[model samples]
Target: RSPSLNLSFLYFCQLMATRGRGRGRVGRGGRAGRGGRGGDQQPDPLNQQQPPIFQQPPPHQHPPVFQQPPPNQGQNHVQIMGQFRVLSPPTFTGADGPQAVDDWFMNLERIFEVLNYSDQEKIVCSRFQMIGDAGRWWSDVWRLKTTAERDAMTWEQMKLLISERYYPYHFREQMERQFYALQQGNLSVEEYEREFTRLSHFAPHMVDTDFKKSRRFLNGLQKDLRFVLSSHGYLTYAETILRAQQIAASQRLELDAAQQTVAQPRMIQPVSVQPPSFQPVQVQPAVYQQSSAQPSGSGGKRNFEGKKKKNQQNKKGGNGGRGDRQPAQQTPRARPP
Candidate 1:
């Protein structure tokens, strides 16, 4: 009830308050709180100059913004759209010969277009790494090594270098000579014309006109077929070519027929049936001799009358002088005659 009792009560209350404060600062396992740990912990030598590790780094004046790259800047910061679909890169196998240039260049263009890298000269040069001749050609001839150098070079410069090594302009000259010099040879008309058309692509100026085309075709045609084609007065290359093909086909058919005949063994031809020969009739000359021996009617009558008269004369003379004169007269008359 006195001042002393009030002092005791106040002391107990302060102790109870102290205990509650301790419980608040300490964790459930009785581990020291963050403030206590700080007091107990040693100072880190590494963080002596810097702020505590727990302290957050100051916020940027603007937000922690990544600096966006400008348009057509480095590829690293570029955000490519998914809509730009890319196709597979084209490959060259080197089987197409010098004409490989067409495929290689065209394929490279297609790849570039698909990849949206039409302006990337470096990308184009880099693609040559896929070529079969890269080691031999792109390395040795051009003396190019680094990617930066290749990327810097223009495509034309690279193309000329390639052409110089593998296929030169002189190849075109050779093709020119070959085109004019091409004769039909043993090739069929259609085959020869096809070759002519393909070769003409190499030398378009040579046969640019239809007349030139026809002339070139006629010139290359076989000697046997040319004259016949020319006589037809063919005006266009198409007409000449068509006629030549027809002629060649006919000639080929004839040749096949002749070949077939020659290849077969020769057989003896059958003899034709003939009519029987007629026999000659025999005639005798004796028939005409017998007919002449037969006397005419008038001649026979005269002979009869003469015989009758001779008989009468003999009868009359017989009576008179027959006896004596008959023998002597017959003998003397015969001697006188």
Candidate 2:
């Protein structure tokens, strides 16, 4: 071979060796380096070292960046519902009367207050509790509203809607009449106050002010209580109620005490004993008279003879003895010898 040709062949062999070594280094790295001379060369998958079947992958130098998906609106609503149900909210059916609807609204509002619910949340929770006819009615109403309208609806607006449906004008009128006519009657102060508070909502215009409220409550009280309370100066409704209750309690206590006094048995005082008085009695003695005794038969014979002679002389001389009538002659008595 010629010398020049042999020299060129050696240079070409050296260049081929350098290129082959660079490819081996790249294969060892398991991937191509950045800014490689070749245009986007891919490493041979077969030549790359495979990780052990059971070996865990290397821990990330920086935690692998993960993009969080957006929150699901339906999931948020379900969570809210679950939280509301824990409070044991009351369910409503349109079959119940207007009073039931009112009571349901009151209860839901109380729960809403406790939970610090927003207006939207209140509307959502209220609609969730409705069932049966009430549910269907609300669904019908809801269907008529557009998305924007429904979203814009406030809790007060919802309440107005419900009221329009369940609480008719006639019913409200009847409630107002009853409220106006309400009297304490046989009801206790507490009970009358409860009824008054309940009915006041039906006729808000009448007792819009505290003074009007107090006056109205006073008017409904029992006659004696009203008369007593009417004499007092202006007072808040709460103060009036407290005073009335106190007076009633005091009166009841007095009545109970009087009844107890009457029911108790009376005590009788013991009578003093007196001794009997004794008086001495006087006695009278009997008196006896002594008679003169005549000598036996002689005296008796002489007296008899004299008495006979005197009697015969008196008869013969009738005119000698005072004027007329003759005396009767006496008979001589025989004497024992």
Candidate 3:
């Protein structure tokens, strides 16, 4: 061989050795791969093409896992007008003392707006008047208007201030009750009338006011009363009224039946008339003999006695003038011949 031929043979032998080693490694390991050092095992194209776990969302991160708030969470801490109204006071029992006027401070705060209390001075003055605290009402108003005063008071203190000034126990109870009813439904003219009738008994003073003003007051009172009552769970007057209506309906049905019974009359019919039958009357023998003897020649009669005797004997012993038809006349005939 020449020099170029020897070089070609050396390269071919090295390539063959490398190929044989790769095949030996694959056969022993049961895998097709290069025997080259430093991990000549390349990534499988299928495995490399898959998306990463971190790159995609987990199954648990679903829409149904979202959270929501409880309904009554914010309801307990509402404010009326500018004043904060706490969670409504618990229900009243005959056991508890009367609710003080300050209990209604929240309600009074709303009333203040109606009276045009915008400034701090006006508001403090108005607060006294709303509670009807008598001397304190005037004193608070004077202090609030003329001087500055800060009173850190609880809702109870506010109610007490109101109770001290204006309403008696009865009046306070009335206000509370009316407010309760108003919350359940919008009042009608009829309901207003009924409320008015009730108030007439306890607060005749309100009755004397003009119908329009009374109506406005009643309407406002109704709204307030109902809200408070509903919160406290004391407003069951609706059920009472429904029961009364049912009783009245039954009574009305009974009354109508009674009236109908009284108004109608029964009728009576008259009996038919029947005529009496005629029967022949017999004459006494004495009267007959006297008449027969006198009738002979007394009244221009010729042989009357003899003819009468013959006729009588003929009727007594045998057939008379129409004796042939006598069988048809079972009794003596009333008609004359």
Candidate 4:
């Protein structure tokens, strides 16, 4: 046999022996593969006559897609009523009661919340940013910034010093004030509840028990919701809040429907026909009657009688001449307007 024929024959036999295992492993690694390995594998030669062309990958059968999540808008995100205000922080005033202290502290916290601040220390340091009366107050609180004073300055220390100086009964006074005034003004149930929760934090003793807390909250609700929530018979604060929220939602729907009804123009209702027994009042049109030689009213009757009597008297006087004229006709003369 020829050398080339012998070589070709040897290659064919080697391919048959190794084909099964090599086919399974070729063109893919476990997990980290393209389309993946399969039984229908094509053979690749160890050596090629020419360099191979790299074919482009096929387009996706199903493309990877992305969907955006919907915005979660609760009561916090109310409609833009007026322009957003960057409110000034309140500074510590001198020798005020717990009420003043509470107001100042709450104001400080509010400004921080509005500015999306998290650091308490940063919030405390920001007191220096106050102006006018507040500026004076801040100066009093933070005098000459010596190295020793700066080292001692902390959020807790500031709070402690301020509380001790301004508010002796900070706990008791705050609890009393908050408990006394927690009315639900113009806010919705969700909005009111958020405020209620915030204020309730100041008065832990008043709201120590869920039962007492629920009662207190119930008392503060507006008349309409208070009446509705009362009837539902929920015990715990959580349950009462849930039930009130449901009522509020339903009330909102009703209000929306009512507003829609009011906004749109309505068809005028037809007036009912009057009964024959209750006839329409007949309005007499004024008549401008021509006045006769002798009119028909009482004055006309008197004038006619007077003329007849005079003629009779003249007849009695017998055939008098034209010169013998009885005084001119006694007709009523109209007064000049």
lDDT of each: 0.67, 0.84, 0.47, 0.67
Clashes of 3: 15
Best-to-worst ranking by lDDT: 2, 4, 1, 3
Give the TM-scores of the predictions, in the order they appear: 0.41, 0.57, 0.24, 0.34
Q: Which residue segments of model 3 deviate by more than 4 Å?
A: 1-125, 128-149, 154-156, 169-237, 265-337
lDDT of 4 by residue, 258-292 (tens): 99999998888999998768768899999987766
Lowest summed lDDT over 10 consecutive residues: which window, candidate 4?
75-84
lDDT of 3 by residue, 106-177 (tens): 455565556444344333443433322344444554466422233344344544444554446776567646
Q: Could you tell me the lDDT of residue 178 within candidate 3?
A: 62
Ranking by TM-score: 2, 1, 4, 3
Where model 4 places Cα greater than 4 Å from the true spot, the runs are 1-155, 164-175, 185-187, 208-212, 222-239, 252-337
lDDT measured at residue 4 in model 1 versus the true structure, 0 to 100: 65
Q: In candidate 4, how many clashes are counted?
A: 0
Better of 1 and 2 by lDDT: 2
- Greater lDDT among 1 and 3 belongs to 1
In model 2, the Cα lDDT at residue 169 comes to: 83
Count of residue pairs whose backbone atoms collide, per candidate: 0, 0, 15, 0
